[model samples]
Target: MRCETIREALSARIDGEPEPVAAGSADRHLDACADCRSWYRRAESLQRTLTARPGPPVPDLTADILRRLPPDWPLSSVP
Candidate 1:
């Protein structure tokens, strides 16, 4: 993949949303592109930091959680 294409997909690649074939191409691009390598490092650092932190506390957690949940029954009205 070209550097521009790889750069465009870098965030999604870091988020683990990229297809395996595209990931291989992006990885190969990172090996040769210094700018992309630095970007990849920064993205990796951010992902790690975000995952390590405790998430925000929810107020009225029971009601809020229930409101956000998907309908459990197949025929249930979601909204």
Candidate 2:
């Protein structure tokens, strides 16, 4: 199987979606392909890193935004 096809399967599997290629075939390719193995490792690591973060807090700016608006601005028109 082409590396692209196997990579697609790997990505699908990582995302909990159906794999484009059979698991056994993709596994066999990954076993013999160093590059694909490396790609898969990086992809998994990235997913873990992204999902593990407690992201920075976002400050609520609704009041500040409203205050800056023109006094005569119609509230109904804002939307």
Candidate 3:
């Protein structure tokens, strides 16, 4: 597998996102590629850092958007 594809899979795996069976291929590539190994380490570190810290308060973007919409806006037409 290419470095770019493996890197994407690495991030997705860290995020607990779904991926194909080829994730194992990415792992094997990690074993062979020093740069990918470093990237994986950094990705892991970042994931840990994010999990350890409190998330910033997330604004309710959906509600904000609803408020901005006109009363006559065709909500039913939105996908």
Evaluated at residue 50, the lDDT of candidate 1 is: 94
Per-residue accuracy of model 1 over 1-79 as CA lDDT, tens digit each? 6667787688776777764456778878888889999987987898899999998986768676677676674435536
Segments in model 3 whose C-alpha atoms lie over 4 Å from true places:
55-79
Quote the lDDT for 21 in model 3: 37
Candidate of highest TM-score: 2
Pairs of colliding residues, candidate 3: none
TM of each candidate vs. truth: 0.57, 0.76, 0.63
Candidate 2 regions exceeding 4 Å error are 72-79
Please name the candidate that would achieve the greatest lDDT relative to the true structure: 2
Candidate lDDT values, in order: 0.77, 0.95, 0.88
Sorted by lDDT (best first), the order is: 2, 3, 1
Model 1 per-residue lDDT at 20: 40
Question: TM-score of the candidate numbered 2?
Answer: 0.76
Q: Where's the lowest-lDDT run of ten residues in candidate 1? A: 70-79
Compose the digit string of candidate 2's lDDT tens values, residues 1-79.
Answer: 8999999999999999999878999999999999999999999999899999899999999999999999898999766
Spell out the clash pairs found in candidate 1.
none
Model 1 regions more than 4 Å off? 19-21, 56-79
